[model samples]
Target: MDIQAVDRVGMILALFGPHRESVTSTEAADLIGLNRTTTYRYLNSLVNANVLTLREDRTYVPGPTLVQVGTYAVGRRDVLKVAAEPMQALARETEITAVLSLWGAASPVVAHVEEPPRLEVVVSVRVGMQLSPVAAQTGIFHGFMAGAPSVVRAAREMDDADRERLQSSAHATVRQGYAAQVSSRGIAVLAVPVWDTHGLAASLALLTTRDVLDVETDGPELAALSRTAETISRMLGSTRPAMTG
Candidate 1:
C-alpha cells in the first residue's frame, strides 16, 4: 500500500533466503530498518493469511498450505498409484529389500517398502516415518542422497556453496541409476527416476538394497532398475520422462 511497506516486504523475502528456516520479528525489523512494531504488524498480517508460518516460539517459516499450493502450482504430478505394481514386481523378483519414499518437509518418510519373505531380512517402513536427508541407506534421506527433488529442497537448509556441492552429487546420483554409500558396511541402493511424459511432473524411484546390488560390477541390475522406471513411466503416459544425463 505504501513505499515503506513495499520496501520492508522485499527485504524480508531476501532475508528468508534458501537455507534460513525462521526469522524473528525483532530481527527482521532490525535488519530491514523497520521499527519492531511495524515489522510485527506486517508479519502478523502475513501469518493470518497463511502466507507465512510462525512457530510456538514466534519464529517463522514458509507456511504448510502455501507450500502445498506452490508445489501443485509448479505442476508436480503424482505417479505413485501407477508405480505400485512395478515396484512390487521388482521386490518379488529380487526378494531382497526395496522402498518408495518421498519428502515430508523436515525429513524423508517411507511411503512404501516391500516386506521380505525371509522375515529376518525384512525391512519394515510405514506411510510416514521421517529419516535424515543426508543418510545414505534410509528413506527420503536416501532419496536426497540419491538426488530426489524433494531432498534437494531440504538440502537448501545448507549454505549456497555447500548446497551446490551436494546438488552436484545429487545430479550424479540421478544419472548413475543408483546412489552408493560413501563407505560400508556398504548399503548400496539402485534407483531409477520414473516420470510423466509431461516434463513438469512428479517422479517415482525404484529402490533395492545392497545384496542384489553387490553381485554386480557390470551394472546389469542397475540397467534393469532403469528399465523398470521406464516401464512405470510409460504406464503413466510419460512419453519423455526427464533424462538423468
Candidate 2:
C-alpha cells in the first residue's frame, strides 16, 4: 500500500500547525530528513494535489483542498451536539434566537440555530450562511479569533476609515470576549465565543429586537449567554476558567 510514501506525506503535512503555518522546502527537507531535491519534489506533488500552495516566497501553506477538508472536519465536531440542549435553553431563557457559528476558510459561517417558541418575529439566520466579516458582529468576533493576519488580509479591500474601525472592533471583541451590533430595523445581535481545547471552536450568538435584548457587557443577556457558552465550552474540553458574573 506504499506505506513509506504515506508516512512521508504524513510527516510533511504534520509540519503545519498553529505555531507553524508555513514551511519552506529546506525546512521540509530537514523535517522529513530528506534531501532538498526530494523535499521540493514532494512539496510540488502536494501542490498539484491542492493540499498545499507554493507561495511566491517559496513557502508552502495550506491550500484550498486542506481548507475544505478542515471545514468539513470542523462541521462534524461534537461541539454541535454538545451545544444543542444548552442553545435551546438559552433561546427559552432569552426569548430570542440562538445561533451557533464556526470559522470558515475566510469568514464565519452559521452552523446551527434555535429560535424561541411563539416568537412571531425572529432573525432569519440559516445554517451555512457566510456572514460579512466587516459588517456582522459575529464575523468581526471570528476575525479576531482567527488572528490579525487573516483580518488584515480580509481588510485589503476596505478603505482606511473602515479598516480602522474594523480593527478597533476586533480588539474590543477580544478584550470583552463578545461582539454586539444593532441593525437599522432595531434587531440586535450579541455574539460570544465558545472555545474548545484548541481555542475558539465556534461562536454562539443571540438575536432579538434591541428593546428585547440588551447588548451591554455586563447585562443580563450577556450573562445568560456567557453561562450557556461556558457550559458548551466545558463540554468541548475548553480549559478557560469560568467568567465571574
Candidate 3:
C-alpha cells in the first residue's frame, strides 16, 4: 500500500466524524493539516472514486459507494447466519417484529428483520437501517457494545437529563441482562444481548404495538425473546449464564 496515500485517505475519512457530517475542501484542508490545493485534489479524487459525494455547496458527504460497502460488510457477518431461524421463530411466536442488529459507525444497524405473518401494519425497519443509540428502544446496543461510551459522548445536543437517562438505561441493561422501552409512538421494544466467546455479539429485539404488548399479562412473550437470544448466543459459542432480566 502507498503509505502517504493511505494516510491522506484516512485523514479525509476521519474528518467525517459523528458531529461533522460533511466538510468543505478548505475545512478539510485545515483539519487535516494539508494545503488547500492538495486537499481539493484529494477530495476530487475521492468523489471520482465514489467514496465521497460533492454536494451543491461543495461540501463532501459519504457517498452511495460507502453505504454499499458497509451494507455488504454487514451482510457478511456469520452471526446473521446463526440468528436467522431464531429471529424468525421469535417473530412468529410473539406476533411481533424481530430485529437482529450490530453496532455500526454511528449506531446499531439492522442486519436482519422478521415480521409476523398476519401483521398488516408493518414496522418500517429494514436491513441496513441505522437505529438511534440513545433511544429507549436501542439501549441494548449502547449498553453492551465496546465503544458505546465514546459514542454517547459524541452524540450532539443531548441535555443533562437525557444523558442521565441514557446512562441509567445502559446500567439497567447490564444489570438485568436486557432492556425494554415503550416509545411515545406507542411502540414497545424488548431487547436482549447476544454474546459470543469474545463478549457481546449483537442485540436481538422484539417490536410490538403498545396495545398488544400491554394486553399480554403473561410473561411468555418476554420469555420467548430471551430464549431465542440465548439460543443464538450459544450457537455463537457463548457460555455466559442465562439473562435474569
Candidate 4:
C-alpha cells in the first residue's frame, strides 16, 4: 500500500472518533492531513468494506459491518471464556467494584462484573448494560473494536479539548494495552487492552480506588492484576500492546 493511502486511513480513523454525525469529506481532509480526493477514496474504500458509511449528506460515520463483525467476534465462546477470570479477580482485589465493558456508540456495556459484597458502588450497567465511554474507570478497557476509538475522539458530546484527550488516551490505550485516570470521583483504574487474534489489543482493565491506583507494578496486587490481564490476553491468542515508556 502507498504511504499516502496509509496516511488517509489514519485520518479517517482519527475523524471517526468522538464525532457522531457522518463527517464532511472536506472537513475530514483538513483534519487528517490528506487532500480531499485521497480522503474520499479512503472513505469510499472503508464504506465499501463496511468500515465506514456515507449518509444522505455524504458525510461519513462508522458502518454496520464494523460493529457486526466486532460483536460477532466477541460473541464467540472462546472470547468470553478468555475474559471471565481476569474480570472476577480484578473485582476481588480492588473491592471498589469491577466490570468488563465493551465499547459502543457513546457508552460501555457491562460484559461482566464482580460487585463488592457489602459496599455499594452505583455501577452504571447490568451484565449487558451500556453507558457513556467517557468515565475515568471505563477508559481502562481492553478492546478497541465496536466504535471504541470513535467514541473517545470526535463525539459531539465532549468539548474539543476533552475529545482530544480521549483521542490521546485511546492512542496510549491502544499502544500500551492500558490507560489510567484519577477522576473527580476520586476513583482510579488501570486498564489494559484485550487484543484479538489479529493482535489488535481489544480491552482489559483494573478498577480500584485512587489511593491505590499508582501502586508499583512490582507490588503484589498490581503484579497479580498484570498477570491476570496477560493470562486473559494469552487465551485470546494475544498480548498487551508493547510499552513505549
How many residue pairs clash in all the candidates, one count each? 4, 0, 0, 25
Which 10 residues in a row give candidate 3 its minimum summed lDDT?
A: 148-157
Question: lDDT of all predictions, in order shown?
Answer: 0.57, 0.77, 0.77, 0.59
Model 1 Cα RMSD, Å?
7.2
| Model 1 residue 54 lDDT score | 88
Please provide, for model 4 over 14-43, each residue's C-alpha lDDT reduced to its tens digit, 9 standing for 90 to 100: 445433346888888887677889777778
Residue 127 lDDT, candidate 3, scale 0-100: 71
RMSD of each: 7.2, 9.8, 4.7, 8.3
True-vs-predicted CA distance for residue 56, candidate 3, Å: 8.3
What value of lDDT does candidate 4 attain over all alpha carbons?
0.59
* Candidate 1 residue lDDT tens string, 73-143: 43453555665677777666666455665545444445566654554655444544554444432321433
- Residues 152-180, candidate 3, lDDT per residue (tens digit)? 54353356777678778988888877777
Question: Which is the better candidate, 1 or 2, if ranked by lDDT?
Answer: 2
Candidate 3 residue 93 Cα shift, in angstroms, is 0.7
Query: Please, what is the TM-score per model?
Result: 0.53, 0.65, 0.75, 0.53
Candidate number that wins on TM-score, 1 or 3: 3
Candidate 3 — which residues are off by over 4 angstroms? 1-42, 48-50, 53-68, 146-159, 215-218
> How big is the positional error of residue 97 in model 1, measured in Å on the Cα after superposition?
2.5
